[model samples]
Each structure stands twice: as structure tokens, then as C-alpha cells.
Target chain A: MSRRSFLRGCAAFGGVTALAASLAPLRELGDYTNTEQFLQKYYKELTPSDMTKVITRIEGEVERQYGIRPHVRDLKPMDGVEFVYALNLTRCIGCRKCVHACVKENNQSRSPEIQYIRVLKMPHGSMDVEKGNHNYDSKQVPEKGFFYMPIQCQQCKNPPCVKVCPVNATWQEKDGITVIDYDWCIGCRYCEAACPYWARRFNFTKPQIPKDKINPDMSYLGNRPRKQGVMEKCHFCIQRTRVGKYPACLEACPVGARKFGNILDPNSEVSYILREKRVFIQLKEEMGTSPRFFYYFDK
Target chain B: MAKLDPSAQKKSDHTANYWLGGLTAVFFSLTIFFAFNSKPHVAAQPEIPLVDKKFLDTSPWRQTYADLVKAKEDLSDYDCYACHDKAKPPRIRYDTNQKIIIPKEHANIEMSHGTHERNNICYNCHNEQNLNTLQVRDGNVVKFDNIPQLCGSCHGPTLRDWEAGAHGRTSGYWDRQLGDINRLSCANCHNPHAPDIPTREAAPGPHYLHEASSHEPSKSHR
Candidate 1:
């Protein structure tokens, strides 16, 4: 049988051979990527074995393109660790440094729809969080009792997105983060509707990041560039967290307010914060999403 | 010339009886073979995974492995229920006693088979081969040292922040060269089965640590 036909048969059976068939087309198109940047993938098409080859090729391409041999492979998923994230609302400057870092770290579509982080500017006296907006373009710490609340997926324990998936395309892992299988999703919006944070965003168009800025260190569901018409959200930096590293947002936070660690480990910093500081979750009374993120307002 | 012979009549009857006996034997043998090969699935059984009321009586929200084992031992010899029926769907159970409904952000979000469900169910992600590794299910096949990238299927934004070093667990400094340990799966920060209540309250802040002398009108201005 032709490779495409063979791949179709493999897909019917559910395996990586089908993925190889789809990847074959990309190899031909690899020449088109003169900029030597990263390519996106459908999550279901790849297996762990396929991912290694893809990662190696990407590293070679990154070296060929940028001449910088980054420790990309060393940053792959490890065997026993569980990664988690935390944000301290007390010190965010509203400078959006983390937002810029995310844009650069992941080859995100510049389209306003694909923004991973939305820095909401709240008014000075009103803590009625409902008033924040992503469109506010005023100066830094723009006047009055205003503070910044960077809104994104809270990575809740009982993700509404995971529960409502008809095809079981999205789910939570042992480490506490929720993920999606790009290939398995039939473009159904059930997960989006179920998300109380409105954290889920649909990709209406294939993401277009400048070729030079593509981050080579990517995981299937993490930093890898995505195609059009799929739903995606925050990954908690799976590529870095898989190793003993920090996320892009935490590194970029200027005030050092964000803290991330294992809630399972009582000795961790997040655990300490949970113990010592009085923390509250947003919209705690409705859908029961146990978010890992925390916001502390300072008087 | 001869109208009918008794011997000829006897020969015809014998031939007909032989064909009928062969057909009956073949039919019965085929039926027995098919019956054995096709594993019997009782269609009469309802769609619910558990038929026993005892298992259902224990917990309305979550199912335990012990319960699964009990249900399997009680129902069938195959123990199918041990693996399939034991799936404890993560849900948000509002504690009316605390006067708190689980937050929507903390609730089970519907993911259309794109995330964990797309992978084999709870048993598939967690190792089932060895019962000795008990308590929380461990992901053996897709073994991630830390939180697996599997969480990013839906939480790409948080994962991105984690990568950029913003949201999750972190050291005091941002290092692009080194990877971060704080980035985790959905379960790292939150519970899969029990929806955790959002306990943090909004505290007021004058958060920025401004350089003390920067705003104090410079000596030149004075």
C-alpha cells in the first residue's frame, strides 16, 4: 500500500505508524522552512519515540538556523517528577514582562486571539475583579489603587474542560496539570464552555510566529507551535518543568512574587505560602475548580 | 421394464439418511465452535459499570480500588470491573456545611477527549500491572519525572508561563539556560477526585518595593 494509505489504516488501528505518514509530508515541507524554525504537531499523531526524533531534528535545525546549540534535549520530560505552578498577585507590576517572555518562549500567533497572558488593569479602590480588562493600554501602574491580575488558566484540580470532553481529548495528569490531545479533538467546544475561567481559547487560524523566534525546546502539548482550529491553553512549561527548571512566567516576574512548587510536598515554598498566608481562589462558590494559582493583595 | 425394486428403494432411503446426519453433525459443531470463540457479553446487563448496590452504597462521589475488587469478585470471574469500573471521575462536591460551593475555576472542566481521556483511562495512565505500588496511581508508561507535559493539552497558557518562568513553582531567579522544577501537571497543584476549595482571600497591597530614594525628591531638586 502507498504510505498514505498505510498511514490511514494505521490510524484506524491507532498507533504511531499513522503519525509517521503524516510527518512524511512535513519532511518534504521542511525545505520550505528556510528559516529553520519549529513545526507544530497534532498531539495524538506522535508517540514518545517519534517525539525524540522530532526533538533531535528540531535541535539540529535550531543549530543550523541560529548557530546556538541550546541544551534542548536535556530539557525533555523526566521519569519521576511532578511539576506545578503558582503566581503571587501581590507584586505584579503590570509591566507585562512575563507576557512578552511567553510570546518569545512559545512561537505564539501574534493575533490578539492567541495571547497566552492577559494582564488586566484593575482600578485603584475597587477590588471588584470583574472590572479588569486586557485592552487597557495606559501607563505603568496606571494611576490610583490599580494592581495587575495576569489572567490565565488556573490549572484546576477538577478541570471543567476535562470532564465535558466527549472524545476524552483533554484530561489531568498525576502532577496536577490538565492537557489535550490535538489529534483526538474533533474541534468540539464542549471543554471551552465548561471552563469557568474562560481560560480555554480556540485557534481559529494556524499560529504564525516569526521563524527566527521559534522556541525549539517544545513538548507535544506545550511549546510546540499549534495549527488553526484547535483549542489550547497554558501548559505550565512542560518542557522545562519535566527537567529541574522553572517556567518562563516565573522567571520573568520582576518583583519575584510568583512561587511554584509541589503542593504534595509540605516543605515546598507554595505549601508554606498556603500554610502561612491567607489565600483565596476566584469564584470559589460555583464550579469548584481547585486552581493552583494564588493572589495576595497587600495593604 | 421393471417398475420398482425393493432393494433400489432401500438404497435411495439410505443415501438420504446419510446426508441428513452429516448436515446435523456439521451444524452442531459449528455452533459449538462459534459459542466458545465469541466471548459471551450479557446484553441484559444495564449500562452502569457496577451492578451491586453494596459498592454504590459506600460512596456517592468516588470509587475505590478496593470497591472495584469487591465488585469484580462479586460479579464475574474475569475481573473486568476491577480496571474499568474503578474510574473515579474528578468532581466538585460543594460542602454545604461550609456554605461554600466549589469554585468554577476549581471544577472539573470538560475536555473533549483531547487530554487524559484520549489516553487510556485512569488505569492506563497509572500503572496497574503491580498492585504493590498503591495509593495514588503512578504513570509508568508515560513516566514523567516531574509534571508531565500532558497537562498542557488544555492549560497551554499556564504551561507557557511556567516555561517563561512566571506562574508555577520557581526559584528566586529567572534562568533561561536551566529548566524549572515548579512547572507541574494538573494534579501537582490540585486534586483530581476532590475539587479543592479556593481558600485564599484577596488581601490589599501596596506591593511594589520601590527604591526608597527614587521617589523622595532628589537632593538636586531640593
Candidate 2:
């Protein structure tokens, strides 16, 4: 071969080697995306043994990372139970105890803090949520002309978030709770956009919870530690409620403003509220989500 | 020769038909007898009784409140019987204008439930005869847990609402069959003397990614 042609070939070979070296990091990024995670079946599609394997794997991962053994369970919904929540506006003293209780119960990320309940301080005479300030920093609450209204996942019968999911990760349970499979989620943010109440929260980073604060009693579909880039919302405290316990938020409200019960049971507190009180739901006219959460004023 | 035996064959066929008829009759008789003799099944009783009379009856509102308070933590520290054992405490002497004479012991208590112009006496709700118990409008004594009855005498509508799980807080199981349920008493959230819950500092607000951007409009307008 000619000397000039040899020189040109060497230059081309050097350029190709440099380009391949720079692209090596992109290939390493693919290593972080586990093939096992990608190939994992949907939550409902998993067989009993497959579910056990997934649960065990999750438990191991959590134990390794957080140095705490999480009791991950896959609790199924009970029959003849439809949960409903009611808030007495007159009784809510604007104390946000419910918010922190929910965070603690749900194993929410403590650093980039995530809270399910958002209590809005609205003007006393108005019912508009837009005018409501969730960031009120006043010294004393029930501030002269203000009333508190807490907003959380309504667990709608016809959830808009479930409808917008590209991957069928989010679905409504038999007991009227909408749940998201963190593993199955694609981080599309479609559910976040579709939710009218702003109930959904996107995990921007891997949840960083202290070892001691991690709620060991977690359900696979509920308060289990979530991966980065997934959507999560309130699942009606499924870890507790599925086992016939009250939601953490209801137990935390000092003023006794919150009421939760099975709507199907005639003797349940929620049934009494719905039957007797002039109960009204938030954003009723807006998309007809038929939310189970209700707000009412008592005389 | 074949024609001679035809009558005999017919006789045999008639005998077979008679036997079949008798068997059908016996079958029908047995069916009729069994159908009439069988007894109807009764429904099994529910594991937990459905009717909770406390939730249903509203006549003696004090009883309902007592049942609710039973599930809650008792106020062991606030023992009224510590001072009053048997005899009723002496009444606080009042002036002609109905101004209360503050006793040395009760000097700390400032009664301000009703407006200043109205002559609101502590004895109106307190049992003068028994200092440990509270008094209803009809002068009946009620336990501290049943203080709702005293409050309800004036606030009838609120009592009704509280009974129906519309006014107060309810915690625990939605299905009371599964676990215990608790409904807060009137005194649990409100001070009976003042009745007005004071305002207090609320919990911290949401810290979101775009919180700064969202608050700009409200700040500029304000």
C-alpha cells in the first residue's frame, strides 16, 4: 500500500477508538437498568411462587440498603368492604397532625419530603381550592377568617390516573382503593397530569428513609420502599386497613375531624355520616371521579 | 296355529302394563310424601349482633356519651372526688348585681363562657349538690364522661350531629365487628368552661419543586 493511504487508515482507526471510548459510559448506564426488573411480570399476573420470589427479592434489597428487614406482604382486599372517608369542616382545627402521620405510616421519603395529606387554609366564607393556601406559616391556626380542608388521594371509583397509565401499573382494588405497582410503572408522569386533586407524587430520587424510621410492616403494593422514577399515592393505608386497622391519619387527628369506615356496613360511622349529614364531595362536578372521600359541615 | 296364540300374547301385554302403572303410582306417592314431610331450613345467627342500641337511641344522650368514653383513655388525674367527698361544697357568695365572689382556692378560674353582660354562673352546669358530677338543665347529675348531655341541653342540634358521626371524630375500624371504635366526647376536643378552642400553630406546609415559582403570583398581588 502507498504511505499516504497507510497514514489515512491510522488516523481513521484512532478516531474510531476515541468515539467508542466516549460511548462506553452510555453502555454502563444500561447496567443500572436491570434486565430482571424489565422482564418482571405485572403484579396481578404473578403466580404465588413468583410473588414470593419478588417479595423476597425486595425484602433482601431493602435489608441490604437500609440495614432493616422489612416485612413485605401482599395483602388482598376483603369482600363486602368499600372504604369511605368523611371530614367535618367545623371540627378540623387546621392542625396538620394527619399529614405527618401519613408520611410516617406510608414510608415516604424523608429528605425530599413527600406527604399524602395537604391541609389547605381557605378563607372561611369561600370553598375555592385555588384561593386556598397550603403553605400557611401563621403562628396560630384556625386563623380568624380561615378554615382548614385536607386533600388526599380520593381513591375514586373511576380514577382518572388509572385511565391515563400507558403501562397498566395503576389499578383500583376491589375495596375501592387505587394502587400503583412501583415495579410496573414506566415513570411516564401521565397519571400525575391526569389527577385533578394533585394526589399523585413522583419519586424523583430513590427514597432515603432512616433505618429506624422505616416501617417494617409494609405491603408489596402499599408502603413498601419504592424505586426511583415511579409514581405513588395514598393507598388508604393498605398495610393497616387490609388487616382491619384504622388509617394512620384518622388516628392522628387531635380534633377528631376525620371519619373513616366501610360504606357498605349500615352501622359503620361513614354510613351514618352519608345517611344523615349533608355530605358533599370535593370537585364533584369536575370529571365525575365519584371519590369516596367526602367533606361536610356540621351544624 | 299363529292366530290361536295371539290372544295369549295380548293377555301377557296387559299384565305388563298393569305392573308399570302400579310402579308409577308408588313413585308419585313417595314424591308427595317426602315433599310435604321435609322441614324448611332456618338462617344461622350473625357472629356479632347487628343492632347497637347506643347508636340508635337518642333519648338519654348521656348514656350514649358514656359508652363512647368507655373506649377512650380515662382522665385519672382530674379527680373531682379528691376535694368533695360527701357534703356539697359551699356556694360562692355573689353581690346584688350577680358578680361572683372569687374564693381563695378558685381564684385562678376565670369564668368567661357567656358574654360579660349575661349572668352566667358556674353552677348552671356544675352539680351544686354533688361537686364531683355535672348537672343537666333538669338538675339531674351526670358523670364527667357524660358531660355531652350537659352541653347538649343547650346545643341540641350539635348533639344530634355528634350522635350520627357527623360532628365528632371516629377512629378505629369502619366495620365495628372487626375491632373497637372510638367516638370523641364533647370535652375531649373542647374545654367545657370556655368551650372556645384557641387557635394554634399549624404543621409545616408542602415543600415542592416549583413552590417558589407558584408563590410568585400570590406574593406580587399581595
Candidate 3:
């Protein structure tokens, strides 16, 4: 063989070997799950009867795995209502109560560790979010020179995650909540990249929630046990909020720093806060996301 | 030494082999036990102190104002007539320093409410003529159930915030038509004796100080 041709042959051999080596992790597809899950239709395509069947299947799976029967529902949004959250920055003592409470209520993975809320500790003299620190480890919170701000899914009026989903797995509901269909998500994580708040959490492996500790109250679009290779986020506690109850984080707050209400109602606490308090949305002007969550100070 | 018989020499060698084998087995077992029974070593935590529990417990107002109102008849706290003579108006006494001395009967109250001993007199909040009812600064009579109004007379802005649902917590339905809303009274979260919220032990952060100090979100993501 000519010397040039011999060199070309070696290059092709090395290229083939490299490509094969790169694809080696596809062997993990052995755990890719059953045909039933693969064949299931998209969330929008599922009829009410089909949804009931899916719920029954989920209930059965939960019962089989956790040894407890769960009542899961596909709760729809209410008419003439749009949700808004108002947080009092002065009252929030950097207490992580809302974070733990949200994890328990949402049935997030315990071991692999998916938490929806991240409380940032900001210095007193500065209002810049860039200066806020999430990993502050002070013994007591509101540590003399800092104010606390918890970040979560802002549930933007114009959600970027919904805009970036490749397979149409997530969408914005009527009541101003952004929801993801775990079944439809391809786990490509484009939406995770698109989020400005770092709101989306992807299950890198099978979620490891203890069976005994699993919250029995489940919802179809909300906190039903998520599988491996899916994305989940804060759905505004859809299961409770739709049923006219306060979000778990709001109920768990000791100082009542968090507030929620229908913005459509002029009499709601959120409306009054927006009207009277010195309120600002996080990254609102720069991102133009128009978040439903509002942060306000009493002074 | 005498020359040994062939069988005797063979027997001695066998006994020596058994002894070596037994020692080997014992050492192997000892190694296995240590491997399985040893505890994993953990790094020592830094010397950061935890917040004391006393700072976090605000359970004095466990009997919220609303609850006391709803269960009014059965409650003895409002029955000021039970201990004192109904005919006589209650007397307020002051020490030589002009600080009001809490009466011996009601010495359990710990007064740390206002700065520089302001709002110290009992009759400032409690009516002199009617012991059970509260008296506002403007001399308006308010029932024990309506302490918020009495408190509002002095703390005008706070009461305004509370009325608008910006001050304390309000649980139950956000949608008022769907379900009833339970607006918590001012005294529920704050102590009448000590209105200041004490510093508290925060629930744990995502990581310990060592792991967290170096962690920061990229500015590009902001």
C-alpha cells in the first residue's frame, strides 16, 4: 500500500475506535424501563378516562413500591384566578424552614437530593441578587449584616423552560403555574439549561425516596414519585392550592414571610402588597420574565 | 538425641503442620472481623456553635387571641372578677423610682415590652374600672377579644399592616369565596410582655460551611 493510503487507513481505524468508545455508556440502556411506559401517550392527548387509567396505574405502582395506597389526582386550574406569591424580605430570617417543608410536601428524592427552594443570604447594604449567597452557614440566621431571600420557580408569565422543551413536555397552566409532564420529558435537559433561576431538577438516577417517608397525597402533574431520567420543578403546590388551601411552605413559615393569593381578586393579600409595599421582581427588568413571585420590604 | 523411627518422625512432622495451619486460620479470621466490624471515619465538624433553643420557643402565646375569644366563657384568664372585689376599682401603685411595681398577685408577668421602661403601667392597657375589659390609649373600652384594636391605638402602622394582611401570617383559603380565611391576631406571633422576635436556630443549609464557602453561582447564570 502507498504510504499516504496507509496513514489514511490508520486514521479511519482510530476514528471508528473513538466513536465506539464514546457510545459505550449506551449499555446502561438495559435499565431503560418497560414498553408500557414508552407506549404511553402525551399528557395533552390523554382523555379523562385515559387519565383515570394512568392514575390507577400510578397508584398501583406506588402501592407496589411503597406498600401504601396513594390518592393521586390530575387537578385542573380554577377559572378567573391567577396565582401570585409575595415574600416579606424583612421578616425572612434566613430560616430554612420553607426549604425542608417544601421537600417533604413535594416528595422530592431524598438521597440523590432534589430540593426546589434555595434561600440566598444577601448583605444588608446591597440589594443586588448577584451579591446574594446560597451556601451561607451562619449559626443563627439574619446574621446581623444580611437579609434572606429564598429562590424557587418564579412561575414566570413568560416561562423560558416551556419555550425550550424539545418534546413539548412542559407548559404553562391557566393559573400561572409552569408544569412538566414527567412521562413526556425526554431528559435531554435543554429546559434545565434554559431556566434563569436554575429551577428545573433532573433525576440523574432512580429517585431514592424512603417508602415509609413518601407523602401519600400525590398529584398527576405535581409531586407524584418521579422516575429516573425526568425533570421536575415547583408547581406552586398545585395539589393543595387548587383545593383552596395554603402552600405547605406558607403554612410552615414561623414568621409568615411568604404570602400567596389570586392576583385577579383586588381584595387578596398579594394585591394589597403589590399596591402598597415597595415590591420588586427578581431579575425582572433584565430577563423580562415577569415573574408571578414578588419580593417586598415593609420599610 | 536418639535416632527416631520412620513413623515417629512422620508423626512429629504432621503435628507441626497442624499447628501452622491452625495459626494461619486464626489470623485470617481476626483480619476478617476487623475488616467488617470497624466503623468508617468521619471528618470533624468545624467549631460553629448552634443557636440556643430558648431563643426559638415563642410558645407563651400558644393560646392565640382568637382561640381565647372563641372559648371565652370557659376561659378563666378573662374572669378578672374571680379574684378581686367587683365593687372596688383596681388600684395602680408605683415605686419611688416611678417604675410600676407589679402586684404580688400578678407578679408572674415579665415586663420587657418597650424601651426605657415605657408603657409600664398596668392600667395603660387594662381598664381600672372594669378589670376584665381592655382600655385603649384614647379611653375607648375594648373587650379581651378585641385587643388588636387596643394595640392598634398605640402601634398605628403595625395594625394597618396587619389589617391589610402584610404583618403576620394568614392561613386557610387565598380565594375567600371558596373557603374561610384565618387572619392571625397580633398577640399570636408577638409576646405582649416582650414584642421583640428573638434570634433563632435556622434550619440547616444545603451544605456545611466548609463545603459551602467556596460555592458560588456563576454570574453568567444571573
Top TM-score: which candidate number?
Answer: 3
Collision count for each candidate, in order:
121, 1, 0
Lowest summed-lDDT stretch of 10 residues in model 3 chain A? A25-34
Off by over 4 Å in 1: A1-84, A124-127, A282-285, B1-222
The list of candidate 2 runs beyond 4 A from truth reads A1-35, B1-88, B93-101, B108-110, B114-119, B214-222
Q: Score the docking of each candidate (DockQ).
A: 0.02, 0.15, 0.15
What's the distance in Å from true for residue A163, model 1? 1.7
lDDT of 2 by residue, A172-261 (tens): 999999999998898999999999999999987656677877889999999998877889999999998988888988887776778887
lDDT of 1 by residue, A227-294 (tens): 55578887777676655556677765544556666666555556665665556545443567867666
Candidate 1 chain B lowest-lDDT run of ten: B201-210
* Ten contiguous residues with the weakest lDDT in model 2 chain B: B49-58
Q: What Cα-based lDDT does every candidate model obtain?
A: 0.53, 0.75, 0.79
Q: Order the numbered candidates by TM-score, best leading.
A: 3, 2, 1
Best by lDDT: 3
